[model samples]
Target: MTPPHPLAPAAPPVVPHVEVPTPRVPPPSSLSLPTPRRRGRGDDALPRPQSVVPGALAALAVSGACLALTLTAPAAPALLVAIVLGVVARAAHAVPASFERGLAWVGRRVLRTGVVLLGLQLSARDVLALGPPELGVLVVTVATTFSATLWLGRRLRVGRSLTLLVATGFSICGAAAVAAMSPVADAEDDDVATAVALVTLYGSVAILVVPVVARAARLSDRTAGLWAGMSVHEVAQVVAAAGAVSAAALSVAVVAKLARVVLLAPLVTAVGVVRRRGGARSGGAAVPVVPLFVIGFLVAVAVRTVGGVPDVAVPVVHGATTLALGAAMVGLGTQVHVARLARSGGRAVLLGAVATTVAMTVSLGGLLAVGALG
Candidate 1:
């Protein structure tokens, strides 16, 4: 068919004007792509600020709710209640990320403030009443218990921070002591909660068990009170435990408990010293010889000693202290992760038990040795 067009029309033979588009490839010079950031030495310094509201609000709400619960059940201190609520709420995953900043503020700032006010509860007059022998025994008990628990904790493979917290709480005034030391030791919220839980459980049991033992032993009211005060974890628990023995016992119990509380400053100082030494050896940033919070606590005690805070205003100050501490507890509690705590296993509990046992045995022996147990 194309034979006639071989010369003239061969080029256009049966060809149709059809267009097929090819995929476009842009020139390299015109393309713009993002280059990933190269991480460097400033990685650990000056952490970027993040949104911190949701967690903070959740913590504050938890604190308020728990504080209300304590009102209904006076046996349950609001501080302890806050910790439990925090753990439960956190495990439910109800805490939102937005509250992170608020929670951080609540945990660190409120905690330090509570420790400062804790000092107003003490006075130089009460310190004098404790006497040298009683003070010596109390100090020895705390020192021994703290050291022994740390050793036991390591052997049991408990986390280091948890071990320190449990030892402090048990050897001193339970949850209050734990909270005071949490910041000094740089402890996490869950660790503090776990330690607080341990101290509260033992302290509660002591309230019931100690009085029965005192009665069975036919101990004098003074002796019974001294025993309760030395061994019990909380001041309220101490009163309840000793009061069950006799009215006189309650008065003595309060005195003995205060002696323990006064020692908190020294204990915190000792811990800071140890940590500082360790940090120095490891070449970490210089750790302070004394924590700023401890200084504030001591100042509060000194002011009270001189009656810088008037008698008429004492109750108001006490109420404020409770509220501040209660809020801090609530803040600390919300950071707890119950499942993670459980996974940490039995060592923490065992460490707490060892501390309790040592504290009771040593303090009781001291009271008897000094003829203070009557």
Candidate 2:
């Protein structure tokens, strides 16, 4: 122990009384950078249109199959086949994790765009060409079936969402109708898929059954066309059913079906109003009375009506529309797990059957009342 030199004054006693202030770090809230959005909600950081490429490719394959069938077999319902193929593929293996977001985008955004373009398939002239009696029959058939199916759905103890979706598909234009109403009705994705599946199944049956019945009932070709237009589910299915009867029947059926498609605008608006009122009562957000895509639909229809799109372009535009919708169907169908749907879907199938029956009955009644049935 070396002693310190005496001249080096003894070190001053350490000051015990002084308290040092801890340097303060500002809380995380005080940081200057803008806070980033949480990831799961799919904010700005998420992929956009490009994200849809993989799923779009998947859908493209379905579209190719659709074209192949259209060119070859000619009688096959290509979109329906696309849906089945997509469902089978997905049932074998879930879509890859990396492709989920893209598939979702196609199911919603791309589907919406396809639906908007569906408007181009119609012209106001073609719609109005169906005289008042024809229009009356259409409106009555759709309105009655839509309301009746909804009422019956509740009696069957089905979920309101499923009931609404099924009714829309059966009454209006099949899968397109289901897609249109799903957003306004706040239906679940699975609910929409179920509705589309039912429509595809029943509509396909109608293509086969309708022609046979027309002959058995001895329905005049014109009356049979009206019946096919009113009772069948999809435009294509109606065409097939009527075409099987005769070329004249095909002409009438397509016109009649287009009239129904035109009526979609008014029907959807009514549904939106009803849904918004219900949502208000339930303290939910009010769904818009017309979705933006629907407005685009109207715009497309009007453009077609005004001859904005050249006649020669119709086929090309129609092809694109089909492709877009086919892709959407593939995406929607892929979400469906047939085994699971079957396990949980007893009521759903029953509702679909009941709805189809109701629609067909109402349509036939309308045509009979109008003397369209000779």
User: For model 2, what is the alpha-carbon lDDT of residue 360?
Assistant: 77
In the range 1-374, model 1's lDDT, one tens digit per residue, is 44665456545567788898998877765557655444322211222234435555566666666667766886887777877776666678776666655665667677778778878888868867777887888888878888899899999999888898888887888777887777566677778878878888888888888888888878878878888888888876897798889999999888888888888888878887888878742123455667788889899999999999887887777666667766667766777776788888477777777788888889888888888443
| Candidate 2 per-residue C-alpha lDDT over 41-66 given as tens digits, one digit per residue, 9 for 90 to 100 | 44113455566677778777777778
Model 2 residue runs over 4 Å out of place are 1-46, 280-285, 372-374
Clashing pairs in 2: none
Best-performing candidate as measured by lDDT = 2
CA lDDT for candidate 2: 0.79
Q: How close is candidate 2 to the true structure, as a TM-score?
A: 0.86
